[model samples]
Target: MAEELRLFAGVDAGASRTALVLGDATGRILSRVRGGPGILRPGRAGAVAERIAGLLKQALGASGPVASLEALVIGAAGAGREAERGALEEELRRRVESRAVLVTTDAAVALQSAFPEGPGIVLSAGTGSIAIGRNREGTVYRVGGWGRQFGDEGSAYSLARAGLAAVAKAEDGRGPKTLLTARMLEAAGKVSVEELIAWARLARPQRVAALAPVVCRAAAEDPVASLLVQAAAAELAHHVEALRERLSDFAIPVALSGGLLVKGSAVRDALVARLKAAEPPVNLVDRGVDPASGALALALGLRP
Candidate 1:
């Protein structure tokens, strides 16, 4: 009889989506799967768990036989809190049995992706923003990632919120008449400013953050939008600076991740300039780093 394969999985549960990397005990990748947004909502943790479990099952196939994997590691935003992480871990375990389940913060895996072997900073500005890193002595440093309510500064959500505010101020003559008013209105797919307001009032964080690209695209022609993007850049830079100060390595690489930090975008460009102009400057890792791989590494005990 053939030996039952000892399987493992890792998940990156980000605001945009959840990705899983499936592998076996031999350190070979078996499959990669994706699902809808996996960010843990305040009242919707169970749904998220079900969605992730469905993907895991899809990757494993229906007849894979084993009731549980050897291990599963998940990196999810808002999972840093013991209560939240414990809840998510419990939920996953209930749906997909595993010998060992590990839950960690989204930023933790992101930092691992950027610098799997040593100290480096990863600045993530997706629907939310966060910076997490480590120093020479293995001490970790983190900034932001407090969620939208606690100020997801430099995030797509923040920029969109500010852009909406700018549109409101411009409409009332309380601020400059900027193209953001038109740009954001169009992006929201509303025919009128009133419709835009209605949509903004009831939109989810991801929907609101969708307008951030509109803000970014309009920044080239709108002074108000440009200022907002610039401010976001500064805030993101501040995050990196805070962590860099805590890191002992002077030449560590700095990785920019997420939608808002895409190459050549207004915010990314401004942030790169700001970091490059720092007193001692900074090093940037231009390649993309998949945090799911980092999560898998942790799952397989591939790194410390």
Candidate 2:
């Protein structure tokens, strides 16, 4: 007789998208599914929970009914607070049939994905930015992640907003000319700055963040764009510096995650170079692992 297969499910819910992965007992992934935005705020827990549940079901269906998950782990953005995590946890409990379900902040899982055990730091800079570090004593420290309003300085949304601001400044003859003005006009599908401004007024963070690549591309040839990229890198390095201060007084490996850092781009290279040149220098991981995979590892008790 063949050995029975024990399955687990891992969910990585971020501000922009929610990803689900189905894995067997050995942590081998069987299926993956993606859905809409996650619960990044306490107020949207119910809706995000519903979306996650739907994605879970979709993954299960795609993987076939013969496989049943023994556990489900979810790492969600904005689930840092106990109340918000509890609400989502309760909702998952009511929706998923797994025997074990765990909930934590997305940053925690991102850290686990890179470090697995021991001490390390993980900086996630997608639509938003947050840094998390774990000490050898298992103490977790966090910096930034205040969302787009007050924090998220090194985030794609921040980069996009800065790019737009530069364009406005240039249009008013208050700032140096740059290629970003034309890029913004192209992205907004408008012929004039006034129309672009009108569209921008109604653009959400995701829509605005979509322009980060434009800024990055122009950075190679445009001085203003280059400065913005450099400034963004500096902001991200600050987050690492702040988190490093809270950790143990030792060299710890740092991992960069999220679309902005993970993707091959100029900003990533600049950020890495900045960290490498920092006083005492930061030990950055070559690449980041998937947070959903980290959730799977956690579900299988892979941690020390």
Candidate 3:
């Protein structure tokens, strides 16, 4: 009889999408699946769970016998809360016979991925924004995970909000004029600023966030848009500065990630420049590893 292969499953559940990857002990990917957003948000648990189950099945098909699985690691948005993490863990255990399950907030995996072996800061700007890091001596620092309504100061939502506001103010002659009015109008496909307001007011977080790229593209040719991008980058750097103060005693590498940074747009360059402006500048280190890989490392108990 052949021995049953023990596989590790890594899951990253976000507000917009959920990713699942099954891997061997040697970090070889066996199967990967993606599904609708996780049920971390309020009042969407049932639908989210159903979506996640479908994705899990797809991943399991390629992973072989789920009964022989050794460990599962899940990094999810809003999973930082103890109750939330506990609930998801219970659900997973009931669904499968995996020997162990580890659940953490997505930021945890991002941090681990950025600095698997040591101390480093990770700036993630997606639908929202957060800066997280751990020092060599085990001290941790964090900034800006307040969500879209309250914070998300350096996130895509922030950019969209600023762009819309600029156009609105310009239309009313209350702010400086800019080409962004035309650009935003084109991107939103609306007749006027009023229509744009209505369009974004009812749109999902990611939907509003989608305009960030458009904003960046216009910023390249428009000075007003450039100022908005610069401001967003500055805000992100401010968070890094706060972390720096908190970890004053430790030497740490700083990594910029997510759509804004990865895209290499003006916003990202401004963020880098602002960080360097600090009195004691941080070292910009490479976060070569992706979040999915970090989740895998966590599943296999190989994370540093």
Candidate 4:
């Protein structure tokens, strides 16, 4: 008898959006869908799960009753830890019938996408930031997965925070002024700085991060903003270098993902330049494939 063919599903879920891709045993894409955020924030878990379930069904689109799904692999924003992973796994199990299901931190899947054998560094800097790397020996090292307030270094949130700092410095006359201040002011449409502060105090951290592009654009012409962008790129490089040292794998590839590194990206070029200038030039991959591909890769492995 011929061997049975299997189907796989992959999901890459972030704070701002989610992507799902279905692939056959041969790693060919069958269906793909993109939707709103998938992370279950403090009070939004139920809603997020609902959305994910909806997207899955919508993507499947009556593809002859998807019960044949062999395996599922998901990379989600908060799925790194046991608590969040457990919740997500249960939710997925409830929604679909699969032979096996795996839920991993978004960084894990991102790294997998970058390095199929799982030995390299991946920096995901969309609404937040995380640096994860696997050594040639299969050891993993992670840095800066803390949320926005605590860390998230070199993230959109970090850039936006830097923008706020620039705005403050400009207002206090303590540093170089920037067009970022005006752009931010325009974003808020606040009459005064005080109102801007008040508005931000009541806003979500991701909401703050939404303004990162404004800062990046301003950086093109504003010295302060430019400094911020360069600084962030340098910081990201530092994290990559640190992972390189810890893993002692100079040849390890580094992959960059996330919205900030994608369309209208301002720091991708600078980041690649800094990596190439490292002690031993780090190999940088900029294929820009969605992390969901990694999940699909994992899922396909689960089949017969």
Candidate 5:
């Protein structure tokens, strides 16, 4: 008789994109799918759940009908609170045909991806910024990630917002002129400040965060853009420092993940440089693993 096949699925539901991966018990990937964000905002839980369900269905269908998932794990942004995670887990359980379903913050999975089963830290800066660390005893500590209204200082949204503010200041002669003004004008197709302001009022956070690359491109030569990038790095460093303080006094490995930090951007370089020059000196991992892969590892009981 042939051995029975068992499957698992892992979902990384971020603020900008949602990625799902289907794998067998042997740790072989069967299928993968991508979709819009599945991070449940205050009033968008239902819609996000539907989107995630659809992505799962697509992944399973693409893989084959013979396979049945035994477990599914999801690591989602905006699921920091236990209540929020419970709600998302219930919603996903109803949608997926799996025996067990687990949900956790995206940071948790990212940490697992980086360290597998030990003490370490994960610093993520995409649409938002957060630093999460785990001690040898398995206690987790977090910093930043208060949300866009009050926090998210080192994130793409923060960088884009600063870039736009610089454009406004330069237009009003309150700040020095920079290349960001022309870049913003070109990107937004706005002729005047009034037009830009009108568009911004209706723009979503993801749309605004999309401009971070433009700011990064100008940072090498543009003084205003350079300062903004430096500030973002400082904020990220602050989060790391706070997390470090909560952990043991010994140096620990720090993993950098998310778009802003993982990608080849000025902010990434600046943050890395800053961390390296810190008093205690940071041990940053050069490569970052995907959070979805970490979710899969958790589903397979490879890591706690």
Candidate 6:
């Protein structure tokens, strides 16, 4: 009998959710499973590591022991640093018996997810925004993804933040009056600016990002909202351009990934328009890019 087809696994461990896929050595995907958040917080590596193993067991349908897995590759946020990767890897090793386990950044897997073995840049705009690229030399470069408090420009968090600021400015007479005050309040389901403030103080990043669509929709009729949207696009464009500068002297393919780059998106359209105007412009990939597949590629030893 042919040596039983070896099994490999891949996981895309995102902040809000995690995606897991199992496949044979031939790369024929066998199972797909989704689970809770897989964020690799500073001190919570063990918990997240447990979640990863759980994902594997689930993908295995509770039939085979994890030792049967030939290898596993996972990409996650907070795993860019050596210490973070080490911590998670150490914890995962204790719980898993796979022949090999690889830990990498969500950005790295995203670039692989988009370009695979080729060299390209991936711009991700979601609850947070970041741009990562790989060049011919296999040297990986990154531009943004600093998180909300520091950077994360062009992210939904940033857009929502700017919207809230606009509301405050308009309300305080510090800036031009606009529809944001009314719309933001409505989106937050609060009757007054005061109530919105109360909600904001306790709200999480995802909740704050939830307000971005309201601002995006209001952009059509509100100058302030419009400016916010333009600035967001400009920020995202800057992310791509900055990566382009470091990746190569010549143009490189740029792939747009993340939840925010949906079809007909104002931010997506505006960013595309701006990049298209650049000298040599940006060559974009029209198809969807999936980071889970990228992780699977790594697991299969298919990535360069």
For lDDT, the strongest prediction is 2
Q: Local error of candidate 2 at 125, Å?
A: 1.0
- At residue 141, what lDDT does model 3 achieve? 71
Q: Mind giving the per-residue lDDT tens digits that candidate 5 earns over 43-101?
A: 66567678888988898788667445788888889878888888877777777678888
Candidate 6 stretches greater than 4 Å from native:
1-4, 62-66, 302-304
116: Cα error in model 2, Å: 0.8
Clashing pairs in 2: none
Question: Model 5: which ten-residue window has the lowest total lDDT?
Answer: 1-10
- Say which prediction, candidate 2 or candidate 5, comes out ahead on lDDT: 2
Q: Which runs of model 4 end up more than 4 angstroms from their true locations?
A: 1-5, 41-45
Instruction: Give the better candidate number (2 or 3) by lDDT.
Output: 2
In terms of lDDT, the poorest run of 10 residues in model 1 is: 1-10
What is candidate 1's CA lDDT for residue 7? 78
| lDDT to native, each model | 0.84, 0.85, 0.78, 0.79, 0.84, 0.84
Residue 214 lDDT in candidate 1: 90
RMSD of 5: 1.9
**Model 4 per-residue lDDT at 293:** 93
Instruction: Return the clash pairs for model 3, or none.
Output: none
Our tally of clashes for model 6 stands at 0
Candidate 6 per-residue C-alpha lDDT over 1-304 given as tens digits, one digit per residue, 9 for 90 to 100: 1334578888888877899888877877888899888878789889998998888888887435435678888888767688989899899889987778889988888888788876788999887888999888888999888778899899998999899988887888899999989888888899988789779879987788888888888888999999999999999999888888888744788889876677777788889999999877888877567788888889889422
Q: TM-score, each model?
A: 0.94, 0.93, 0.91, 0.89, 0.94, 0.94
List where candidate 1 sits over 4 angstroms from the true fold. 1-4, 62-67, 302-304
